[model samples]
Target: MNLPHDDKTCGWYAALPPPQPARRLSGSQRADYAVIGAGFAGLAAARRLAEHEPDARIVLVDAQRVGEGASGRNSGFVIDLPHKFALENPDAQFKQRLLRLNRTAIAQLQSLVDEHGIACQWSHAGKYQGAVGERGLAYLAHFEKLMAALGEPFHAVEGRELAKVLGTTHYSRAVFTSGCYLMQPAALVRGLARSLPENVELLENSAIQRVERDGLGGYVLHGADGQIHTPRLLLGTSIFTREFGYLHNRLLPVMTFASWTAPLNAAQCKRYSGTFDWGLTPADHAGTTVRMTQDRRIIIRNTYKHVPKYGRSVDDSTRESIRAEHRKAFLARFPDLADVPFTHTWGGVYAISRNFTNFFGQLEDGVFASACDNGVGAAWGTISGTLLADRAVGATSSLLDDIHAVTGMPSLNPPEPFLGIGVRTRIRLAAWNSRAEV
Candidate 1:
């Protein structure tokens, strides 16, 4: 349950300019407030706390450099729609409320980007949810029904339009929603870290070992290099919250893989003959997510693995297998561009729940925690982190209440071997069922 130290070999990280060397925690430190995990959630929480208490000494700590974890590893879609397979919530109003929350997060992010002039390739180009075969079409149809009930307008695109939007003729059915935006996640994280308020201390490359309360005072956050004593602490590490036994089996680690093709040359782009800068999510929950980067690179994310406790990254064999699957999926969607090969491939962890609900709230006195993005980490993490900060200071809002009711405590997972077996079996079955989409 240690915070991840492995590189995870994320293509997103390597594709960007080299990050500045991380400043590790040195000697001893004390803070008025401390947040563990510098991903979206933790960063948002720390930023919010600083806003509310500007003069307070605030510390934001991460296991790796900013944007190196799930925050930076995500597909970079700030989706207004809910996460995949997240409609299990019976309260219909919650869906609309969640959508509002998502938009709020997006607005806040945009404000930061504009105010700081962050160079994260932030785009409002929207996204396409495209379906190639009949199965994917069915899923799209279901989404249409849901969107219609919510009174949301979604433009259905197909034939030449789909081809032009997605850079391929594989999609016979597709819909474009204006709610989502795309970006280079690594850049966004680094930009966020750089833009943080001067009072908020940002600590990176500090793997937290454990948290223990001092006998007569505040909490002691023991890390690899040093210790931090703080009166207030927030846990935003998400999947690794299991280390503190706060979330326990309420969340499970689900790893997803993505491969980025080498940027297509001008001739290659012409031969592909589709849009060069666009992003698309799969119509099916288990289908592949594709993004045609502004740089003319095609990235495909398709496989999911329930990485074990001791490991967060996929092994070489799994990587090879997914590489083949990526190529197959890529070719199916873009047979004409078969020669364009992927330049980078990697996997990142997501915390899914047994019942598909994410969680948020206080764990103990002076300790607040938020996790379980369900599947959409970018927006969900941002909103949850902001909400957690409010909760920490006893502030109340309608959005915070909605998060509380919507994310109710996660369902208990089955015991170890059985839980792992059940999750793996379900993933395999679901992947096989969605083979056409994947």
Candidate 2:
């Protein structure tokens, strides 16, 4: 199947100044190591390879510019907590492992941000999982039990208390936890790409069209404008791993939508927001993840779609419908700020498995793959990419074992038509159940 590619961007990218011009490949090239996809995983992979082999020629390529794809399109939460979906069981040891890897990922990203002095609004205010009704609150309370069992630190807060952190008294209850960070998603990824070591060459507008083993023991990557042959190739293409026929039916390509409100005036801020900026995810899985940004805009993300394929942007009708849903969410939370228009709305793709697993291993000769973030890309991507590079360099760590144990190869998905119907129906039922939270 052909992997989809869309430039559908959110307001995060638009809020920033124009980015640096992209560098594209124009001719055939050869490298000692090549990492495909310059998102968090690809960026970390290239950096780690350079760290281990500073003199080695490492090439990093992406179809769009850095921060233009899903990496840049996320809500900017670098969370180390077990994501809501991670509550598969009461396995305390498993929870510890999940949190440990996430912590390592955060530490690695913080090191880069400090070393390179990247200004991406990197905040340590953490995040909250809040609910707006009894049902939603029950979800938060259930998650609280798991957190307590893991010895996690958190404080429960009601609507008025929660409003101080988020600036609106919309949520009925919440749990404030440590170990999460929020930032401008696009800005942070761009900064990471820009700070890459000098030994690594970053190429944009260079989507990998196909890959085949060259007769001379190298993999040939055919880009639109050029080709690259490398002794070692690391695939960090995420959902597009299907494009290379690696994770075919194992990975599902799905879409999610988000919109950003226009900047609020001082009076509006005084009336609507608190002194501090904060981010929060819904207590309900199908609900919304919202952020009261540092720059005074309210960003809300909700709703999911099953788009098994990519390459084309979503239609305007879809965008408008999501925008309407976003509007509804906005009004529910901040009816007083209903005038705050969603300046930009967009969608991004996520690769999911039946049991929320990721893929990390050798796909073919000289081909190492690390992808399927299971909806937690920022921290997961960083750690997976770093560890993948280690695997490629023959460097072993206990973390690798944990990765293999938890994120085993994805289970097979149901066949299409039925698959589509099943997924769509599940999402619809879940979303309907979470409608109050949304």
Candidate 3:
């Protein structure tokens, strides 16, 4: 299917060689576990399940190849900090455990790279998110204070201190820490796909159509060409889980558009004093993240605004718009590099739950769902998969139960009729506000 170009220079994830397709099952099969979606969540879950039950049968199926979905299209930055703090939702006690789980998952990913010898470039350099204006600065200041009050230790920098690390005065205040790392994300996903043990079966290009009750207290997962019957079913579709009826209403799949610039020469690099390895995001209402790859190409991404009106797919217009915005953003932060041309651009869908937190637990008997990474999927997806595996294996883990018990969905304006139109209009106004600052 030749979808319109989401952006141009194949996304950062596409720089690596395409992964070998997975083997598809043709007939009805029975397994102890059936994981639907072979991204980090499914693959990690499958691996964890195998570790806990060496003799159990496990199968993983993806509509496309492994890492082909949002997992493969990410900016390649593995984050560790809680994207949303406990103070952000003061009433939610589980945020503490969730934050710790994110930290633990990132540590595990680093360990996986070492133990498996995955060749993806791994760097411990941290990520930076800052503010440029009064409103943005106020949010940063309060957030910094909240972090301190909550005992979340981090390097908070402002003015000259921030400029020393980033080589740009574009930010007024910033938060920095060694809590995250940048990786060749697609390569890591491919590496994991390659290393999945012999006992687990992976299916690529195998679209699951429906999961129905099996009548005998089990579930039957039907694909276009095959079926899998198991006592337990886990859906790891991430942002794409909207296609399934159960999650469609509660999950919002946003389009994140990204682009990569041509390789920067030493002179171009020196414009920022070669300190361009870090990832950046402005604390504005219309948040945009800036990152550079190992190849010295900068990557930029922002979320989808038009939902019901445009649906979830990306078109050439949206792709070009994001590219234009990125170039302008880069130049605003580093004016000397405004003339540089971007070499590649692309976009992908990411799932968001109504409540802003990714979810866990059984949506139905024997059918479990995990999605909505709140625009940060890498580390959280791994953590969720591992937690799910531990739960499936009957391991006594309070963390898993804690996450499932914390409920109350995030409410967004419905994407229907006038509501969808209003949502898009609000986004346009926000973008206008952002451009006005420029």
Tens-digit lDDT track of model 1 for 369-414: 8888877888888899999999998899999878887777888998
lDDT of each: 0.85, 0.86, 0.72
Candidate 3 clashing pairs? 7-345, 7-346, 8-344, 8-345, 9-344, 9-345, 239-351, 354-410, 355-410
* Candidate 3 segments exceeding 4 Å error: 1-10, 85-87, 91-93, 159-161, 308-312, 405-415, 433-438
Give one digit per residue, the lDDT tens place, for model 3 in 36-70: 88888898899988898889899998877665566
For candidate 1, list the clashing residue pairs, or say none.
Answer: none
RMSD of each: 1.4, 1.4, 3.1
lDDT of 2 at 173: 88
TM-score of model 2 (CA atoms): 0.97
Q: Which stretches of candidate 2 lie over 4 Å from their true place?
A: 1-4, 311-313
Clashes of 3: 9
Model 1 sits at a Cα RMSD from the real structure of 1.4
